[model samples]
Target: MNVLDLLEQWKQSDTFNNTLSDDHQVISYQEAYLRISVYSDWLASNSFTQPMAFYCAQSIEHLLMLIALMFNEVNFVLLPVKSTDVDKELFADQLTLKPHFCDMLRHIQLTKQAQCKTVATPGRIYFKTSGSLGTPKLVVHQRHNLIANSRNVLTRLPLNASSRVLIPVPMHHMYGFGAALWPCLLVGASIHLTSNLNILRFKAVERQFAPTVAYLTPSTVGALLLRSCKSSQYEFIVSAGDCFDRQTFQQAQTKFGRVFNLYGSTELGVVAIGEIQSKGEAVDDCVTALPGVKIKIESEQIAVKHPFGFDFYLYQQTRDVFFNTGDLARGDEITGFSVIGRAKLSINREGRLIAFSELESQIKQHQHIQDVALVKGRKDSKGHTIVAIVESTTELAPDELRRQLGKFLPRYATPSKIIIEPQLPRLVSGKINRKQIALHYEETEF
Candidate 1:
C-alpha cells in the first residue's frame, strides 16, 4: 500500500490517540493529522512546480512536513539542516521550513533553477550516503517501496500499537526515517525523537519516557558501555551502521535487553535484520534477509536482490539485477549471512589478500582496544603496508599492541604500524572514516 493508504488506515485505527513526542512536547496522532491536513492544503495553494531541496530537522514539525509533502505529492530532495556546502551545491533551489512549520508554509518561497527531475507521481524521496567509503550520491526510493520496506522490517522485528519507540538517530537518515519511524507510523506506535543525544541525555530520556523499543547505532552502544549504564529491560533494540567486537556485543546485551544486529543500506532499505528470539533463547550472530529479499555471496562479496529496492541513483540510470554491496560476507541462505569487510578495501600483503575489516575485528577482540581501523598505507616492491589506527580504553604502547596482535595474527598479517589515539573519527552512521583516514596518512613513511 502507498503512504496515502497508510494514512487512511491510521485515521480509522483505534490507536489514533497514540503520541509522538520529543524533548519539547508530546502530540497525539489526532493532533498530528490535523496539522498535516492544514499544511497539505497550504501546499496545494502555493504549489512548487519544480523539485526543491528540503532541510529535515530532528523534530515533530519536520515529520509533519514530510507527511504533508507526501500527501501533496511534492517532489523534493531531503537533506539535514547542517548539510555541507557540497550538498547544497547539488540543488540550487531550496524549500525553507521554519518553526511552527505549517504557518510558515503560507509564505514559503522557492528559488529559481531546478537540478533534480520532477517525478510524474508523488511520494519520491531521495537520501544521499555519508561518503565515508566513497563519493556520496542521492539514492532514490519510491514512496510505496519505502512503506513496503518498513513492512519487511516489521515482519522480522516486532512492533505493535502499544509499542513505544525511542529514536536518537537523525530522521534524515534511512536507518531512522525508514526502518524506525516509518514502521512506527504503520503500526500506530508512539515515537520519541531525541536530538543531540549523549550519555546524560540518554539516561534522562530513558527515565522520562520508558521506551519499550529503541533504534541505536554502534557508537551509541559504545557510549552506553563507556558510561557503565544500568541494565534496561525493553521489548528489543536494533543496532546497525557498523560492526562491533563480540565483547562489546555481550556487554551491551547484559546492560540492555536483547540486542539485534541489523544490516541495511541506502539503496536497499532494510535488507536484513537479526532473527527474533524466543524468551530465554540466546542471541545469534547471523541475520536473516527480510521476506522477498535475496542474499548471495559472490567472490566473498555480498550481493542483494531486493524487490523493494530503490529505482536508481539521481542522474544515473545504472541499475543492476543483483546489487553488489562491496561488503564481504560468509554464510549460506539457510544459516544467514554475517558481514565481514569491504571488498574494495582489501589489501595485498606478500601476494596474499587481506580484508582489513577482518583485521580490525580481530584487533577489537583485544581487551584494551575499544575500536580500530586498518587502512592501506603505502605500496612498494614488498607489498601494500597496512596501518592500524586504534582507540583504546587506556594508554597502550604501539609496540606492545603489535606484540599482543602477533600472538593471533601471522607475521605478514600483523599491521606494519600501529597508532594509538583515544578517539577515532566516525561518520554520522557510526562507520569509521576510512576514506578520510587514508587520505590523511597517505604520505606517512613506512
Candidate 2:
C-alpha cells in the first residue's frame, strides 16, 4: 500500500491515538498526521521545480518533513549529515533544506535552485550507503518499492496497532528507515526513537515507553548482555547490519525469547530474515529469503534480485538484473542460507582463503577476548599478513593471544600480529571500521 493509503487506514483505525515520539516530544498519530497535513499544504504552496537534498538529524520534524516532501511529490535526497555540516559548493545544483527548529512548516527554507543531474527523477527517495569499506555513494529507491520492502518485513515479523517499537538507530540509515520505521507506521504502532542509547538509557527508556519491539545492533546487544539488565521479554527483537556470533545469538534468544537476525543490504532492502527455530533448539544463522526475493550463491558471493531493491547509484544508471552483493553465503532456499562475510575482505593465506568474519569469530571464542577485528596487512612470502585487534576483559599479552589461537586455528590462519585494546573501533551500526583500524596500526611493525 502507498503511504497516503496507509495514513488513511490509520485515520480510520481505533489506534489513531497511537503515538510517534522522539527524545523531544510525544504526539499521537492524529497529531502527527495533522502536522504532516500542514507541512504538505505549505510545501504545495511553494513551487519547487528543482531536486532538493534534506539533511536533518533523527527527529519528529525530520520525519514529518520527509513525509510532507513525498506527499507533495517533490523529489529530494536524504543526506546523511546535518545541514550545517554539508558542503554547499559540492551540492550546489540541488536545492538544500536549511536547518530549523521544531516547526516544520514555518521553518522551511531552501537553497538557491540549480540543475542536478543525479536526482532528476521526481517521486523518488534517496539514501547514502555507509562507506565503511570505501567512499559513500548515493543509493536511489522508488518510493513505492520502499513501501513494498517494508511489507516484506511484515511477512516474517508482523506488527499491530498496539505494537510499541523502540528505535535507537539513526533514521537516515536504511535499517532504521526502511526496515523499522516504515513497517511500524504501516501498522500504526506506537513508536519511540532515541539516539546514542547505552544500557542505562535503555533501561530508562524501557521503563518509560514500555517498548514491545526494538531494532538493535550487535554492539547494542553486547552492552545489554554486559549489564545483565534482566530486561523484560517482548514479542520479538531484530539484530541486523552485521552478523552475530553463535554465543551472542544464544544469549539474546535466552534473554529476549525471540531474536531474529536480519540479513539485508543498502541495495536490497529487506532480503531475508533468519528463521525462528523451535524452542530448546540451538539458534540458527541460516536465513530464508523474503517474499518475491531471489537469492543465489554464485562463486560464493550472495546475489539478490528483489522486487523492492534500489534502482541505481547516483550518476550510474546501468545496473545488473541481479545485483551481486559482496557478502559471501552458503546453503540454499529450502534449508535456508547463512551469510558468512564480505567477499572483498576475504584474505589469502598460504594457498588458503580465510574469511575475516570467521577468523574473528574464532578469536572471540578465546576466554579472555571480548571482541575481535581482523585487518589485512602487508603481503609476505606466504601471503598477506593478518593483524588481529582484540578487545579483552583483562590485559592479554600479544604472545599469550598467539599461543591461545595456535591451539584452535591452523598456523597460516592465525594472526601475524596482535593488538590489545579496551575496545575496537565500530560504526554506529556495530560493524567494525576496518579502514580506521588499519590506518591506526599502519606504522606499527609486525
Candidate 3:
C-alpha cells in the first residue's frame, strides 16, 4: 500500500495522539495529515511533477513535506541538511532534479516550483549511503518493498495502534526511515520526533509522552547508557544501523531491561532481530523473515531474494534484481545465524584469511580491552599487517595484549600494532570510524 494511504487511515483514528509535549510545538498526526494535504494542494496549483530533491532539517515542516511527496505520488530524494553547498549542488545535478531548500524565505519562493505529479503509478524512493566509500551511491526502493519490510519488522516487534514510538534517528537514513517512520505509519503508532539527540531532552520527552517503544542507533544508546537513564520508561527498545556492544547493552538493560538488536542494511531491508540476553549472550539468530523472502549464503556472503527488493545501480546500469549483501554470516542451530563482519573489511594475510569480527569477538573476551576495532593497516614487503585500535580503561601494554591474543588467534591473524586510545571514534550509526582512526595513526608522533 502507498504510504499516503496509511496517513489517511491515521487521520481517521481518534485513539492516537496527534500532538505531543507541553510546548505543543510538535505536530500531531492529525496536524501532519492536514499539512500534507495543504502541501499537496500547493503542489497541484503548479505544473511541476517530476522527482524533486527534499533538503530540510528535523521539524514539522520537513515531516509534512515528505508525507505530501508520498501522497502526491512523487518520487523525491531526501538529502541531509548537514551536506555542504557543493555536495547539495552535485546531488541535484546527478539526480536531474531541482533542489527545494526548506528555509522560510526559500520555502515561499520554491512553492511555485513544487508541482505535484498527477500520475497514478507508484514511484520509487531513493536514499544515498554516507560517501565514505567513493561517492555516495543512490539506492532505490519501491513502495511495496518498504511496506513489506515494515510489516515484517512489526511482526517481530509487535507494535499496534495504541503503541507510542519515539524516532531518535534522522529520517534521511534508511535505518531511520524503515525502522522508525515507516513502521509507525503502517501500524498507526504515535510518533515522537526529537529535534536532536540530547539525553536530557530525550528523557524529558519520554516522561511527557511515555512511548512504548523507541528506535535508536548504538551511539544514541551509548549516550543513554552513559547518562544512566531509567529504561523502564520504554517497554521495547530496538537498536539498528550498527553493532550493539555488550557494555552498552548491559548498561542499557540495567535501566531499560531488555532490548532487541536488529540487523540489516540500506540495500537489504530488515534481515534479522536477535534477543541479547542479560549475560551478554545473543540468545537467538532465527529472525522471522518476511513472506516471500529467502536468505542464501554463497561463499560465506549473505544474499537475499525477494519479490520486492532494491533495484541497485552498478556501472551506470541497473544491476541484479536480487541483492547480494557484502556482509558475512554463519547459520547455526543454537544462535540460528549471526553476521560476522563486512566482506570488504575482512583481512587476508598472505593466503590465510580471517574475519575482522572474529578477531574483535576474541579480543573483547579479554578483560582489559574495553572496545576494539580490527582493520587492515599497511602491507610491507612481507605481507599486510593486521592493526587493532583498542579503547582501553587501563594501561595494557601492547606486547602483553599481543601475547594474550596469540593464545586464541594465529600469529599472522593477531594485530601487529595494538594502538591504545582513551576512546574509539564512531559514526552516527555506531560503527567504528576507521577512516578517522587511520588518519590518527598517520598524524601521530608514535
Runs off by more than 4 Å, candidate 1: 1-4, 85-92, 99-122, 226-233, 276-283, 346-446
lDDT of 2: 0.75
Clashing pairs in 2: none
Q: For candidate 2, write residues 1-446 as lDDT tens digits.
A: 44478678797666789988887778888888878888787776766545577775667777777877766667777775543333343343343343343454445556665644443567777777755222466787888898889988988886788889999877778888888988888788999988888888888788888888988876577677764644565777887755555666767766676778788877888899974454344445678999999888877788898999999986788899889988888888666888776777666554345777767777888889889888887765445788888887676678888888988877988888888888888999998777898788743545
lDDT of each: 0.75, 0.75, 0.64
Best by TM-score: 2
TM-score of each: 0.73, 0.74, 0.68
Worst 10 residues of 2 by lDDT: 90-99
Off by over 4 Å in 2: 1-3, 83-107, 117-119, 276-282, 346-446
The true-versus-predicted C-alpha distance at residue 420 of model 2, in Å, is 16
**Candidate 3 lDDT by residue in tens digits, 1-446:** 54466765765666346553222356566665666677777666755534556665555566666766666666656677665422333222112112333333245334234333222224666677644313466667776677678777777787777877787677777777776677777767777776566788776876788877877765677766556646565677787544555666777667665677776767766766766565436433234345566777777787777655677642244665557777777783234456666677665453234666656887888888889987666754224577888899767688888788788765767777788888899999988897887676632322
**Given candidate 3, what's the lDDT at residue 399?**
80
Clashing pairs in 1: none
User: How far does residue 290 in candidate 3 sit from its true spot (Å)?
Assistant: 2.9
